[model samples]
Target: MAPDLPVRAHARRNREKLIATARAAFATADGTVSLEGIARQAGVGIGTLYRHFPTREALVEAVYGAELDDVTSSASALLDELPPAVALRAWMDRYAAFVSTKRGMLDTLRAGWASGRIATPTTRERITGAIATILTAGAREGSLRADVPPGDVTAMLVGVLLSAGTDGTSEQTGRLLDLVLDALMVRRGPGT
Candidate 1:
């Protein structure tokens, strides 16, 4: 099958530049980066940024979605490059780091909500699906509990973020999740 070369090519470049700029901004600014900053960094006009994302929420959505996409991609890499347990553990740790950065993103999302910016449900769903895929693989490989749902793991991780957004929460959370996973491990019956 053939497609329109020029139009598709231009769109792809714009999208890639936007995502790259957003990632750099997050890395440097740690969620304090502004929309105009992203536009300038991406070498696009504010109008063009608006054409792609009419509101701040739209831009934040792109950043969060891109981060999740990275996480999902890492899952595949970890699976291929490491054992199931190691990969899952690495994924969990990365998820923790993401949660730490996401606090500021939530504020942006709230502003977007107040300003009538539409939420991107599809992005959220894709992230959920990616985690589920990786978790299922880990469980099947006996590195994680089969009884646990990927959605549940996501919820638990998120819960940790909410509960410990301050006052040494991250420190406690790592230990808590470690214990939970330990308890949830599948053990043989007495005679099995």
Candidate 2:
């Protein structure tokens, strides 16, 4: 058992390295990136890559799932460090990064999802839940509006991100995000 432990640990490390390398490649790759290239970049052999992910679709699915998990889980962590409204804005930036990463795998993801080769994740639901958590906290703190539905916020965010496009500059994206945040913030009228 002791001997097996080290081997397993090494394998796990290799697997994680592959996933991380693939995520970075997919984030910037213009089109389909080669699996062999990914394996080389991860400092592993093609066989190791195959051992961890049997197919290209499998790798894409894993990367997508990992990105989804990161973005969804960041909301509460941001809230802990910042006010609710600020947390929401930070979460949006994270969400935008998630969207950008997804672009490289979009073709494979769509096909795999359409053919049911990959299990469809509850992506929209999970994202909406994260938004709801921050929005609820903001509402309680009087930093954000209380009347907006979380789903609406989700829809608007999608629109903003999609409009930004892959070619959109960071400044453009930031401005768009600010507009969305402005809509969610509570308005203070004349002096109390």
Candidate 3:
């Protein structure tokens, strides 16, 4: 059946509300929170929530996917607005914040994985691709070292984010990111 144009806007609004509510609920609560509670918090009926997200895994994935999209999509815009290296640093900072938020979902994600509901590769690829985009721009601009592999940088960033999200403070995370950025920069031989 085709969608009713009149209801489409309403449906989108409800879906957004549900995703936002679920993100907040998952962050505050340990492990899986009730779908009914999420629907109630979203001010939508359980049927609506189920209609948008048939399973808990679906809801979790939607919330995480939206967050990933927001972070990754900024790369191009950042590159357009700032110098390559500066844009890359800003993008990495956003990525770190995204990881910090996602750290709250570790238990839920593991549970989903145990049940074979979430695929790990897709998430990894999406993030790596985003970082690659920024790194490629920096390489092309000669701001970052041409020989440094973007994938290697991505893997190291994963460690930084994991460490920061686990116990390190934001200030420490910023310092770690600065160190990574410094390492990525092309070294100048002699000043004119």
Q: How far off is residue 12 in model 2, in Å?
A: 1.0
**Highest lDDT, which number?**
2
Tens-place lDDT digits, model 2, residues 1-192? 699999999999999999999999999999889999999999999999999999999999999998899999999999999999999999999999999889899999999999999999999999999999999999999999999999999999999999989879889999999999999999999993
lDDT of each: 0.71, 0.95, 0.85
The sequence of per-residue lDDT tens digits that candidate 1 reaches over residues 1-192 is 257888788867887898788766765564477878888888888887888888777778888877877776777787888766667667778777776666666777667767667453454455566667666776787766777766776677677667766565666878866765665466767996
The alpha-carbon deviation from the true structure for residue 7 of candidate 2, after best TM-score superposition, in angstroms, is 1.5
Q: What is the lDDT of residue 86 in candidate 3?
A: 96
TM-scores for every candidate against the unseen true structure: 0.73, 0.97, 0.87
Give the candidate number with the greatest TM-score.
2
Show the lowest summed lDDT stretch of 10 residues, model 2.
161-170
Off by over 4 Å in 2: none
lDDT score, candidate 2:
0.95
Which residue pairs overlap in candidate 2's backbone? none
| TM-score preference between candidates 1 and 2, better one | 2
